[model samples]
Target: MSATRPPMTAVGADRLRDELEYLKRVKRPEIVAAVAEARAHGDLKENAEYHAAREMHGFNEGRINELEAALSNSEIIDTERLAVAPRIVFGAIVDLVDLDSEAEVTYQIVGDLEADIKKNLIAVSSPIARALIGKNEGDEFDFVAPNGTKTYEIKGVRYK
Candidate 1:
């Protein structure tokens, strides 16, 4: 991991914590039981059930460790505590209008871990997010999307 801490929204951090808890408290025990059951019926040389159960156990443990590391290395940012600002910023919900198509869309600037395009959550380091940052409501700017260059007008910017 880099020495610099990666930024994560408070909500994202909470979600990771919940997943970690579930893996440790629920999934881990379940996998352990499955492995034990498989072991009881196992032949040492060619035990498919035992091998499958062990593979699942390894995957689950790896995920648990990944979640733990992510939580520990992240800088959790709380959007609710941020002072409401007119300019777009990290964790800000921004409303934008495509200049050519006149289509309106909403996006929340979030950390990499929490970014889900389907959910309108854009990563802070994304091309659009980088363009959106520091822009105020009604500001229009050109963005070089993968498709082509497009202009977008900031319709609104809210911290929460």
Candidate 2:
């Protein structure tokens, strides 16, 4: 059997692609120039600018490699193209009500790379997302959080 690739949203994959393009086409060349210019100035031993440029180059290359690998191993799921499903799944924008706080919040279940709590995007592997998975609207589930266990009721699920 083939290995299971990580599920990533189409938006996430596109963003990574854009970043990779910028790093390779723009950042890499800028770093190369900086390093060359630094090297031209003086001796190699005590050149702080030269070392900094080399470090920046290394970081840029490492990020490029990481993005390339991640993109290669990802399965991009376009929520806009998928039919709406009953259960909360990847690419689902979940509307939930906190049992304790009585607060309503919306979160999109996304890949780890796309998760940002501030933006209301939760990773599929996250505790809340894990508990929310396979659950339908009006269903309640308890999930373990960093603070404590919390209960939430699924209010709605939308693909877009």
Candidate 3:
């Protein structure tokens, strides 16, 4: 069976590796210890602690499996190897100016797994990122937000 996984940048791959390591070395052991301690209390049916521990262990195992599969199938793209133009691309840090307010906002276009809106890291598949892709500086793009259509001008694009 062939499975297709989403592409990931080198930085995103590294972050996933770090998370997997933490889950394996720290979280897994902690959950095991908790389960063992809960089991020692004897009554299995009414053991709230045991049930909670089991639930946590289940979640941890599921996350581990997911991370493993993603990492295994990931096509790591190294930004340094790409001879891209001064336009939006995966792993590019883009600066945009709100046309209406004239306010500047910066976003790092990353893989889906690494996209954190709070950190201003947008996924390549996001609406804003999609509109920004292949756009050079001074190019204006419109976004269909929930409020209304908003336009933004590309101020800059950096590889770092």
Instruction: Compare the candidates by lDDT and give the number of the best one.
Output: 2
Give the higher-lDDT candidate: 1 or 3: 1
- Candidate 2 local distance difference test against the native: 0.91
* Clashing residue pairs for model 2: none
Residue-level lDDT of model 1, residues 65-119, one tens digit each, is 9998888888899998887578877899998999999999999999897789999
Counted clashes in each candidate structure: 0, 0, 0
Local distance difference test, candidate 3: 0.88
Give the lDDT of residue 102 in candidate 3. 94
4-95 per-residue lDDT for model 3 (tens digits): 66778898889999999999999999999999999999998999999999999999999999989888887888876766757667778888
lDDT of every predicted structure (CA atoms)? 0.90, 0.91, 0.88
Q: What is the lDDT of residue 73 in candidate 2?
A: 90
What's model 1's TM-score?
A: 0.90
After superposition, which runs of candidate 3 have C-alpha atoms over 4 Å from their true positions? 1-5
The number of the candidate with the highest TM-score is 2
What ranking emerges by lDDT with the best candidate at the front? Answer: 2, 1, 3
